[model samples]
Target: MSAVSRLWRRAPLWRLCVYGTVFFAGLAAFYPAAYLIRAIPSLGKLHPGALHGGTAPDASKPGPGPGGNGGPPGPGDGRISFLPLTQGLTRAVPFGGHVLPLPAGVWHPVLSAQTGPNGAMLTDVYVRTDRGVVSGMVVAMGTAQPIPDPNLLSVDSPCHDDRAYARGELPSGENVVSCWAIGATPVHDAPGTLNPVVAQAVDRLNALGYPIPPLFMTMRWMHLTTVPKKGVGLEQADVMLSPAAPGTIRLPVPIDQWDRGAIAGAPAAAHFVDRMRVWAQEWAPILERGHAGTLDPTTIPDSLTMDPAAPAVH
Candidate 1:
């Protein structure tokens, strides 16, 4: 007989099935109720009126990184000179920890937030807003789980996922889409040829047992769009950067045949789209940080949002 069966036989048989039912029912009640609780609106709760986490910077600071300008400083007069998005955030809450294109408006300060590591070696920063709690992740191709929509334009990112569980949805019906940010392309997932020599070198590396580098090294944020369904999707969409040189900013790859400058006015657009070339050189250290696993999300900028002088992204 199985070890579990033997132990059961030796133990008391009182209410065996009843005990099992009670144990399972308790868990059943707990899980579904938790998910359902999210749908309800709570009044008078503290809101995260500001942007939190390293993935997103304070709108006022206009510096760089996930939290500031990803390029050189702006003019001395305080304009910051970076892309608008990188300059500051529009501000808001968490609808499942996702970041959307900052809409035009004033964003309030964040009352509080919580951050932590997530599946696939990614970092998750949860921000509370007037609407609700939203999640923002610093994604890495090695561990990100993205949801892909067939209705949207597709790219060559290797780490994109089509599963429903991969997406973060809001009660208002908006969905977040993700990809290689604005300045990157997947090395192997590109549909057509990437120069002949580079392709050959990538093949050789795989043969020697090294995986092609993932796009997450440089790009990560999700694209915000209004979806028809209560659910939407995320894809590791890409743009062409790196014109065979280091730190050389190139124009974005057009999603359709059109004039080139659609994204020219976007905040930090140039730096974001071109970040991959610089990141590829720093890949080794990036990998080390991901594996180290000591990220703290609690410090994701609640203090920054509280300052009225702080530049707000909204």
Candidate 2:
């Protein structure tokens, strides 16, 4: 402060000139800087849709007729509707050998329908896999139809054909095959004990008139490499079964119960009850017709009674 005061006192006019130059320079820089900041698309505080020329007219300030292009309705104008299909779903059955229940639902409509080359559709069955969401539009069809190879549906590896409906592939037109239980990877925490219950259950289901495809039985191991800091770490394991395709059977268990068991040994029983309720409440009409020619629900086993020392059925 002493040195500054001395200098200012010695050269008052020079100091004034210097201060004036600094003040002008700051003032000159401010407007341009502000203009540049505003020029940045992301940095600007403008509403994104409005900035892109998508302005909706203010209805409060009324203008033209009812049919006028009031710039497209704002968020909730009833333009979109979501409805669950209330018809033709099969009853959920117990997954043959294990305490796990099979998933119950109709074949997702989009997955069931035939789509053209560039067509896209959303599916309701959401599976959270090791891969993120595992979402996106599948190529509907192409110029040529790919051959129906059994290997194409393998769950052990990534699917090569990402198309929803391959080009030239014919729909079997058989609606009875409502679901496809393909690529079910098994998770056996204790291999020797209750694991074989799953396989036994499959056998029991086959005896009870469900088509337990060979592909569905091929179980793969899921591995998790990262150490989970909180909660239960999700391993890369899943039982892939299609809920479309007729003659295909679904077990009544929700996916969560199948992934991990409840504290009590009653998930399988709960699944069976829930499935029956769905059948009674939703599919009663179609179920009465016996889609597969008089289904005897009584033939299905309610529980798997097994000895602890029994041999594994792998």
TM-score winner: 1
Candidate 1 — which residues are off by over 4 angstroms?
1-260, 265-290, 294-312
Could you tell me how far off, in angstroms, the CA of residue 7 lies in candidate 2 after the best superposition? 99
User: What are the per-residue Cα lDDT tens digits for candidate 2 across 1-314?
Assistant: 79878888899898999899999865443322222322432222233221122221111111121101011111211110111223222233211111111123221111111111211110111111111111111101111122122321221121122211101111123221112111222222222221221222323333444343222111111111122232111111122322212232233343334321341255553443333233222222222222234444433333221101011100
Q: All candidates' lDDT scores?
A: 0.26, 0.23
lDDT of 2: 0.23
Name the lDDT of candidate 1.
0.26
Model 2 regions more than 4 Å off:
1-197, 217-225, 228-237, 242-245, 248-314
TM-score of each: 0.21, 0.17
Worst 10 residues of 1 by lDDT: 74-83
Where's the lowest-lDDT run of ten residues in candidate 2? 305-314
Q: Write the per-residue lDDT of candidate 1 for residues 1-314, one digit (tens) a residue.
A: 99777767777564487588899875443332212222431211222221211221211221112211121111111100011111223433222333222222333221111111211111112111222211111211111232233323332222243311112211222243322222333344443323221233234334544333322122333333434553222322111122221211122333221112443454343343333323322322222222233323232235322221112321
